[model samples]
Target chain A: MMRTPFEVPMDGLPDRVTIYEVGPRDGLQNESAIVPAGVKAEFLARLAEAGLTTIEATSFVHPKWVPQLADAEELLTRMERVPGVRYPVLVPNERGLDRALDHGVTDIAIFGSATETFARRNLNRSVDGSIEMFTPVVARALENGLDVRAYLSMCFGDPWEGPVPVEQVVRHGRRLLDLGCSQLSLGDTIGVGTPGHVTALLAAFAEAGVGPERLAVHFHDTYGQALANTLSALRAGVTVVDASTGGIGGCPFAKSATGNLATEDLVWMLSGLGVETGVDLESLVATSVWLAGELGRPSPSRVVQALAAESPGRRNVTQVPAEVPPAVEEE
Target chain B: MMRTPFEVPMDGLPDRVTIYEVGPRDGLQNESAIVPAGVKAEFLARLAEAGLTTIEATSFVHPKWVPQLADAEELLTRMERVPGVRYPVLVPNERGLDRALDHGVTDIAIFGSATETFARRNLNRSVDGSIEMFTPVVARALENGLDVRAYLSMCFGDPWEGPVPVEQVVRHGRRLLDLGCSQLSLGDTIGVGTPGHVTALLAAFAEAGVGPERLAVHFHDTYGQALANTLSALRAGVTVVDASTGGIGGCPFAKSATGNLATEDLVWMLSGLGVETGVDLESLVATSVWLAGELGRPSPSRVVQALAAESPGRRNVTQVPAEVPPAVEEE
Candidate 1:
């Protein structure tokens, strides 16, 4: 081996990152099939076993609206809570918040939209109206000594509105923070976020007195910009990221929507960057493979697919060994 | 709509970027099926029509090694070269260089490996021996007044070697630059590169007196980090990127390899960032779709898949519009 001069230094990077695994709630909610409560609980356990510190368990929503996660309460009751892991459920309004409290949920998330069109279409309210709806829920949760996270969707681009202005997203995001939500997750709901957009949004948020410490990033892989946007967010000083196992979930309304950023893919980047994520890559890959099998589909995540295909059992089926006669095999 | 304060200014970003379209050469070379010469020519023309300034036409390697691109000469002869568009071909050795010269090729690229394992497996030589083999070819091309590029493969990770040290990659890359190549394209051959690693390597390269202006980035999406790595490179001031149309091409020796960073995906990000790439995104998407049809498979690019599925003709086939009740349709 030839020795070389000069080593690459990892500079200006956060030493640790918090991955908010949303596979159980956000990922499954948009899935067509209704995963059994037991199966959902098992998936959470597997995620915890793989060393994820934060996992969104399920959502408190009307069965008539999101039939896939109607059994959220049952899953909460049946699931084993790991001692060090945090399981937050999505709560849309006061009624949902009440239901979550009834289920003994300690952490909760409230979603708001940055775009007026998405707010009206998805929540039957204008952007201001949706904030009005979330205000009471956030106040009640904060009073109950519960941690609340606010998710501001369409922070990048809106399908109907096209490219959203940054000022609008900042105003909407700050309002949610003012409502007493501890952290605000900027969401690239349609996955149209570019790295430059991410940096600009983060800068705008910073200018508004909201720093990375009080922010998280949630991205969709709709146009394959999720991971890239995540990288930009990380560089912008964000430490919290939201991702899905097996890259499941696409918006029903937006047929072009793909899954959230895959947890395996995020782990791969973090691991290579020497960032301390504390997540086991191989175990995460296995869990995604198992979930993909249950869904009766291949994982949309490139990492999961590559690792699964590399295993001995599937290797022969998918990949033929290189036919080069080993004329120069070196140890 | 509520009035808000703040604009996310695109600060410290390059105003323009150059995309090196490699679908015709690097992409097709790894494909299993040999694309017809006429179709290859058409693909090249389509890329140019989409405003790609630099297109790698084909590899001038022996037919036995890269049979998929064995029609290199035919492709060059049959294709209508767009004015102001540079079509470069990969030249493996002196013989390949002679073939390129015979065809009046103005631009040529030579590939070298950073890791010993890949060098032996892909080129049947050690890293040193591979560089030695390229010295004469690069010198000959430069002497003939042709623009030459050197592609340094596995700069980030190797299938067998795992994470290659940054020092090793910088040394190899600097040597290639010293060999009279105009540009050095750092390739993450196994797709294990993360944003942090890209920064670190670029920093190491800078320490070795190599600037981003003389560098291009080639990333694979095997682990879904290609776009993310590309973003990092762009942020690090690298203006040129290598991408494959329809996200074609996976390394043959590396079974876990996936497609190159899709040109459509790159253009989508560049456009969103307000960076000028001079490429028409819809035209690029159409070309990828057309090529996918010719290949008898769906494109691996998320942008191509999303845009194609969103069109009116394919809308009813892959996606069923949401059946949400009008009670919530406030928009």
Candidate 2:
């Protein structure tokens, strides 16, 4: 019965929201340019200052497949980690996790796909084989007293396999949960899943003994359903959401998909809903803008641009077509 | 209760989601290129093919303000009025509405801002003063048996006035409702308002005898919260939602606010949630892509990029610097 000072309803409001920034690893992995280790270090530091408590900083994958993140160890070592924040890195196998453990990383993540075709195409493994691969990885990571996150890719659908079944996502989710993954990140890898798919997938997981608290939702705004799909997951009891800065990181295999949801944009969403993420909207946008600039590009987060709107004489009217005559400047 | 093969938990689903496409008018108004009248005609035709039944075709504002949409007359005259569809054109005043009516317009939308500063800056009047201006316009349009729609801009907040009080929005919304506007399109002009604000403002409207049934939402992705805000509004019983193709259209006065919610993305959200927008994802993405070329830019709709992933050989990876590069190939 607590009413806001304005006497507005606060139905279904959450106490805290977790924002997982995937920009450093997932976002930077597929980019054509190799971000300087120092540039990425500064990027993470800026995100930390903006109040991002959990950011996926780097991946320990073979540099051959993802040359963009080749400076993972150097970047992580150089960045100043905030005291209370968690910085998890992606590990494809024991070798990758070994590299992370060597750096004394307390939080680590493992990844697996749901479909055989997707697993083979994206990860070069069979469906069952990928889980088998993670079993030992998860077990060893847990024994070291490290928190583990498992990313279950293609929970929505696969390109080779048109419609992803809810049961398949549930089975794999439970596997990750049973294997001692502290949290499960369900991804619409291709941004093809709708809210219906999200609800069904989550319900299936719940029925299979994994509830909302153990889940995080990751969506790519490929078809523009990422936020909507995230909302569906939240209504079903998810509190953890993962996004990339400036909407960075497109699935290399998913031709139509863009970046994961923009962290700046996601923070805008969480802050606007009265859901506290402990992040400053202005600072988050500023960080995104700076990152886009370091990469020599405009920030994809629309909120960042809008917040920067009054930049003295920024002149939004695009450059005059060279052929067209110019108009007099407004008085 | 209803169930679908889409795997949605039918029990938790919201019923009857509606979409409002402001693409033709709002989407085209800010484009640099003056789309040929024929292309605009084809664009509207494609939107209908994608299952959007409610479309805002053109704005009858003075040519001096928006030279891009000066071909409003030709656009409406040649537009194919699809059966069972409601085509609404924006009318700024008596003259604007007169031209709209002259082109066999059966639906006309009149707009006024909720903030005094915005009203005066955008329309040269106070909030009450602007309402007074639209009263006769609304009355005249409704008397002519045209379905009248009223847009209330800055309903959530204003650039000039930070954090618009829910009370102010309610007062202005009630005035528009009282004027017999068949529907009200509430706009978050600055992209500063979040889901919490949406809940606050919508709850405000409900208290003032306004039901969600007669409402539509228009959000800017300024902070990348448009979809999130739209989702909250939908949860509050709003069915009709406003969007633009490729997230096209930025307010000339409200510069820096992101484009309107992309129609392709909006449709993706609804269809996935099993809310039934009835839009074909492929066709919708196709239309958005076509329009992007028409505007000589990449679409702001992330889903359009994602849908292209389903096809082979082509990908949307080219870095789109804010301004078109001189050496960049056109088309």
Candidate 3:
């Protein structure tokens, strides 16, 4: 029997990668129907059970802005905190950070856009103004003994600004890191990025002394280049990848944006590359299938769709509820 | 105004690539409805006009097997052969090659599988048996002064054989190449490939004295790794990429297999990377959208979907057919 079918790594590839699962928060943020708080908690728990160490649970953005994740505090409170797993929530401002801290959140993320047009349209501030706003929010979170992650959106292309310069993105990313954010996730919100753009951006970041350890890649599948761009980042030594289960999430900024890189798809690639992501492929697929049912739509993920079609009864997350019923003694 | 929004190529990446369009033949072969011969010819003409130098027009396979492409000879006969464009068709055996020769076909392709299961199911023979069957087909095609391309399917994963060995695939690939094939397209029929797998396979092939110049990559987007795998192959110096317009063509052998890498999506990535493919993105998207409407379904190509959503009337292929009508004078 072949013990390792695709368990051999090629030269210059990472031995292991960290998949920062963002399905619970970013994936559902743009959803039309607000998911129940308990359901959100259950989804996060399943993701953690599938061996994902970091799962972005929910966002603390105002209900008017992101009604889908309005029950952030309630979801976090009801969630079982898996040991050794980190649940990061999106914090837009100091007020959101304070709310997250009140819920005992250890990890929080702030977002800014690399392009002025996106920052102005999405966050109601200029690019520099958005950075200034996030500066204090990140500093306060770090001071409160929480790990901060800064997401620099529109890192690749801006719907209004067109192609963003590599140097500009690196500058904003470095600023966030300097402001005490533990990690900086460069986002392709419009999904117009190619592998060459990713390679060039990562190389520029390395030249600016921002190592891969401090960088994560968050890509959208609008142009279907997410996985390819992720590969470019991986080859450039960036270990952290942000993906959505069931390939959920449309960018609130870019209306044409599709879903993020599907977690199942990402896991498939990593497993094939012999890169350890500590993710259970079967379990992850189940979670996506379950989530797809909850969302009342078919998943946009090719892996989820393919696997579901393979086994008719595979999406059994609904069959087994989040809470088990007490054994009935009937004879 | 930005002179080149996405015209910068990265270091160590291919500056140019050859996109072998496979929509008319491979793409439509799996369709349930048979496209009209005129439509097929129009599609081929539009593909050539959109700057594709090589288009797989039709397959000479028996009509009983692929009813969708049954009008292969008629489509070829009615097609206006563009200058500097090579139109190749699939020839299953000596009979098929003879039929192609009767139509004055200049280039032909023969397909075999690297795995025995796919070989038996697809060709009704073992891997060796299938290769032996194709040896004469390829030799005959070469004897007729035709360029022969051998497609080796299931090079990455087999539905029955979990993960094919890299060395074993290389051996099969070498056999096809040694059989006087001008080019060999390694197919991931099940779409279970990663960048590492692609890199490793290409490297192994190089070791076996088969360089990337003699190879083309035919990937399916089942797990959303098609573009990534193509990127890896491109980085490894394999410049020929096989893609289907509108992301058409599900493998008949693998039920779970999705469409091949969409030519529009591939062109988007290659264009963004500043890799010249000579394909006009707008015109190709229009072709996909028009064909999608003709097929009574939405296109699976992300670029086509995104661009169509952005422009309501961008799919003007219906407005102006490939053979434009002479401008009517005022009556």
Candidate 4:
């Protein structure tokens, strides 16, 4: 029997997608090798050149806790700031916020996982305990005129508990949003989430008044469902997506985590759908390729290599072969 | 406010999802080191032992074209011949068929791309031209009492021809199925596909008279949508899914292409959902880890390392930590 090609119905999609680059913090945190601050700054500069409006530059968490970002202050101090790019660093408490404010981080992301176990394990405190620790930080950041974005990790699934409870995700999201988070990004930490799971979770969040306008969907490409799940979220009206250039980072806590969905891959999907993301696919690829060499292996972003390979010597935005049915087998 | 845990309506899922393991052919093809015939045979043997009833063992395409499978005949001859396991080899032409039959392969997969540019660049023919070529090959194999599976590449998107039209894909799928293909697998060659694309294509295929039972969904994780797309297809009643273990393969025709969906990742999703695939997750991880060592890189399947790392010395299936979210970046 003959099957016709799929017709994508883009009836309601966000006009412009905000790509929050998390390469510096989320990306480097999971890597076992300690990247030098100079190299990390170089990487951040390249990402900014790729037209990323917001990059999760660094985390102000205790250096002893996250050894990867021990040079956080130095990295922030040395970066060649992109004029319009908002570099949001994660600050866990008053001390962390103090560091970011001192370093002139105008926008800050105050993050917390949904589950008690993750909060306890990752932040070394229970969910409420971490939030209590965060309240003053949020108040101070807001008082200091900083824009705060709360990350609710394990929004979809947990490592200890199979599937995440929606109520928990929404509850966590509400706290962050109520605390003037401006935006709440729901994360599927382990990448075990499916579209249905995403739909249900987000719908629940919406029902409780967390509309898509103030929501961003952060996904891991663990199960190869990141894009599909992202598509579902897009149709459901998510405007902001957190991604990494060259898909650099992972969740240090998740055992088999891959990097965030490659920004190149995300931009490719968005640009292909005619959805506006303000990201140049070609520059993103060039940036990823450069990072790949620095990382000493091929990048996790399959699109970067495929597009670069196909258009050898051609400019970045050459006629893209439509719809390369994703063949990547990354777990 | 505590959010309740999210859960999918698993009761309605289909029983016994089809496992189309392409590791033997697709997996080995991308390896830079040439795996000896005995090693390839050993690989296939291990695959069958993992209870994979359907394995695309080897391709009889010219050795000059794909040097990795130069020993296709020798490898097939030494397969373990596990009962109920359908070992299909790629037969591009009549000569290839003779070789596969010589090795006593009862099932064979004959593949061709949908777009003219790809057909010409990949198989050296037009869409119509390749179909004409495959007809005789399909006929010969059917006459030899062999089951035939037609592989339609670039069904959703073409590498050269941007977005492939539904009308064109349908025409190709109909022709191949008409020529006696018992099963047809639609591929997103460059891994640049979405669920809307998959759902639309599969729905069109079903509308064209092909039932879910007669089709397989082949996706790449290029955009990290392969597994999520697979789930959408499964929801639409399609069962067969082609995945590679440890994500150890890439499209020869596509550049910077990543590995296929790690079989371990696919199986983990399936197992979590209670779908009976009949493959052991721990053993799959072990095999992927061992193979990764042989290949001198980490396995693409993050599940293997995550699970292995958590347990360290034992293959444990303990549920992920309830507190921390499942590792998002790893997958």
Candidate 5:
């Protein structure tokens, strides 16, 4: 059976959207099992082959913090960069920036927190201190002619702090964008946001002189609100969305909690909405299925599971085209 | 950590919504394991305790067609109907209606199909033939002073015939509504719809003189588009949404496919949007967890799994109050 949704155009949405593929970085980071650098490189290649224009290759966080991506340098060296595709690496501090610069990386992203508790716990610094930490990193990355993207985590709610104020999130986000970052991807780190909150936050950003062009949304499916929140963001004029292939990540603290929204699921909705995403859903499902096999677990993505289960022969990674067809234009 | 989403009201939505809970009927109908009549009774009672006003109790289909719900009569006899809560039973034909009337059923639903293939396969009659068959059932129910709801399945797509036309669905829905049924529920049986399709379908219904007040939406989450579609429906002025507790009812054909949109997830979004549902999130989550224990399988709902994992002690079914506290008004 065909798995694609019927094309039906909606109003007040962008003609095209940029899906920032974060499978190799945000996805694998949560995995307890270590995937080899070769497999990581192959995964990046498959994502690019499946028509993703921007893929976060790997993060430069220390091995002690994220052992899964310890082979960041090795994976960058082994992987062949696809032409016209942007590969961004996460830089935690000056050291991570230095490593990214040394590898000739053209794009880098810095992670910040909207709440004080997450800033102290994740970065070992206060919210203001973390901004101070990123100021230098952003300035240095720009000096090297690298494009910078900033991630503001816990923008909606914190585990310790119930609900982060919309004003506080807008205030922190402006600071990150003020530090020469081209885009600020709002992160629902614990995935506790809904569509109304999403609209309010975007309105808050616009009120503070930041347009939707400079904003992105990154949501987790912990409470199954990620896709619905993404729809709200699109309706509010935001165009970039962050998703992981096969829905790979899960919060280590909350065992059953889902992490990032699955890229395939997002693609299915985008395709159905008649929005242009420049992605091939079938090839993307195949890539996720193959990766699930290497990880020895079934994918958490509904589209991946449904499509993979429908055609079990598609599970063979080798059968997937190294260079799949281009995205289908909706009527 | 609290599982309830922060209240953030959106513009242009109704102040309240009616969640038509179908866990006991549509949810259990797909289950291969036949639950005891007593357990099914307890599930209905707990749903009422969670503040769902309209709960579909069970299907009166013959045992040969649906063995899982063959104990429908016993279930209705064993369960105590809460005051002010409506328990609607599915009456397939005159025989089923007789059984429901014999047991003092004041509310009933009749299932029809929009697509010709689904109508033939599911009801063993053509689209028009099925409507003809339902004419007498709906007339009798109305004459008996029963509140009747008509379900038009395969409104979005059919597994055998893909991408059903919006006009065909609207026409069939009008016929069902014309049969003295108070409301017509559009069902996306295959879960292959997006926001744009939802908006277009509702608009078509309006053009055909059926207002949103008389329309309900029942979406499956097979492809992860249910909540997003629901968001669109709400924006298009739909006030009634169908959901199953614990997200049960996987398609019998596809093993990994999700069945209905989980009620807890919908409540989370509605609560966050400042829309009154009269459901307590904590109590609802506990109910889903308790039901999961009886089924010996984890819930497919992200909200259920997250809350259950957050508070391990909440898994004790006995701890859930037989009569929980009333709904929290949004401030």
Candidate 6:
């Protein structure tokens, strides 16, 4: 009943990948139930214990806009920050950046939009206006010796606008990178992309002089294309992938909709591919199970469900040997 | 609101793929509710109408073993046989083959196992015994001018035996093909495979002289690796994939466990990759929506859910043009 996949390496992929865990901020943002700051702090600690080096802790957006993380300051003050683990908080504007700086946050992320409709709806500004708005925020963060990661949302397709063009996404991505951001995370907000689209987008970014080393991919599982697109991104030389533990952003049990790609599912693939992710699959599954109990529903993650179903006694079973003895022949 | 994905062709993949729709057989087999023969027949007809050229009609296993598909003969007799569409039935042994022949089945499949544990548990025989048993069945079917397909289950991982060796799967696959099976489908029953494992297994088969033309992949989504694995298989030159409409075998609304890779999900990715599947996404999603209502649950497919939520008028809104005019810019 061992849940680990057999290691089989493929060519043209990085030997190791950085899994950017986004459960606390992106995942909990979509939940209808409000979690206590103490519980959120515990979740962050558990994520660090599960070997995630870069966990997006919480967003500093106004309480009126994102009430889920309204207690962000309380949670950050209470949470035990692991030494080597980086907890990056999302800063929406100068006000959010001020709050993040006040909290002594060293790592921050700014959310941008590739589509005009999303930019207007989410940020109340045009795409160009939003970029102009983030200019000072990113510059100030860099000036203060903080790392800034910019998220370009709707890079693949938009719910309001369909089939985003490759060149337009590249242009916006390059603009965000030029804003003194350390890295740009491409967001397929609607999860409508395929492998080819992913490859083409990365190629465009490369053509624009934004190498894969400075790019991360944040894919949703709304259409179940997240992992396949991730595979394509890896083959195209990208090394950072974003995932949410338990796929918590959208409720899988209700109406069969999913949000972020589950961290456990992503880790399972990375583990089977012999890619070093520095994650303990067992510990991650355990954390998801414990969190699911707190959420009052089963986890949306397939790996969490599969592994949690096994008896606790079998959880620590020895891994299957690479070469097993042949079965007895019967003619 | 168009459900279609924008075509973005990827390199190293076939321009066209044959999807072996298994909804009528493998999909309903695991459901606790028993669908009527007439309903199964209608389902097959709808699948054909949705542009699936190859549909697995039903299985002739004993009713005692699979009461769900007990009406296989009735289904075959009642179902409309579309011209140029292949309706393959599962014939477990000579008895099953006799039933299929009685119904004038021209395409038939035999299920085998790569692991000794599954062979014994499922077929009451060892791996060798099962192959020996299939030898005459395949031979008889071929002699009758029926196209024979062999299913090698547990090719990736076995629940009881754990990760199966690639060589073992290739050997059994070769034996099945040698018995006159036109195609051998490798099944990841527990869905523990990754892209690397998929590539390695296909490479092993190619080294054994069985090219991708003679191979199909049947992947479950238990651990959510099915789509990613399918991507790898396609990259390795596989053009046939097995999927179930609505992902009906396992209920996603119940405990978040998924069985087969949903046809809608597969078609979404394939369509996005510019691979022709001949399936109209709208018609397919509508069919799945109707079937889900009949089954008294929502579909596990993300595509189905997303599209079904759209207003009826929006479903047919002219597809977003390949090149959209840029949005009005405001600085």
Best prediction by DockQ = 1
Off by over 4 Å in 6: A251-255, A314-331, B251-255, B315-331
**What fraction of the true interface contacts does model 4 reproduce?**
0.19
Per-residue lDDT tens digits for candidate 5, residues B192-311, read 899999999999999999999999999988788899999999998999999999898776545566778999999989999999999988888888888888877778898887788767
Residues A1-331 of candidate 1 have per-residue lDDT tens digits of 1111112335666888999998888888877777789889899999999999999998876777778788988898899999999999988778788888998999999888888877877778898888888888888999998999988887876656767887899999999999998899998776767777888889989998999999999988878988878877887899999998878886554443466888988887777677788899889888988987777666788888677766633323233212121222222
- How well is each residue in A182-276 modelled by candidate 3, as lDDT tens digits? 89999887677888888889999999999898999998887798998888898899999999887887543334335688888888888878889
On DockQ, the stronger of 5 and 6 is 6
Give the alpha carbon lDDT tens digit for every residue of A84-130 in model 6.
Answer: 99999988888878888998899999888898977877777899998
TM-score of chain A of 5: 0.93
Cα lDDT tens digits for candidate 4, B35-147: 77877777777887787889888887767657778887777767678888888888888777887877788998888777787777667667787788888889988899999
Q: Sort candidate 6 into its docking category.
A: acceptable
Across B1-331, the per-residue lDDT of candidate 1 in tens digits comes to 1111112335666889999988888787776667799999889888998899999998877676667777888877888988999999888788888889999899999888888977887778998998898899999998999999999887886656667898999998899999999999998766667777898889889988999999999988877988888877877899999999888776454433466888988888777777888998888888988987777766788888677766634323233212111123111
* lDDT score at residue B242, model 5, on the 0-100 scale: 97
lDDT of 6 by residue, B27-98 (tens): 887766787898888898899999999999888877766777888888888899999999999888887888
- Which TM-score does chain B of candidate 2 obtain? 0.88
Those runs of model 5 whose alpha carbons end farther than 4 Å from true positions after fitting are: A312-331, B312-331
Task: Please identify model 3 stretches exceeding 4 Å from their true place.
Answer: A1-5, A251-257, A312-331, B1-5, B251-257, B312-331
Candidate 1, DockQ score (0 to 1): 0.35
* Model 3: native contacts recovered, as a fraction: 0.30
The 10-residue segment with the lowest total lDDT in model 6 chain A: A319-328
Output the worst ten-in-a-row residue range by lDDT, candidate 6 chain B: B320-329
TM-score pick, better of 1 and 4: 1
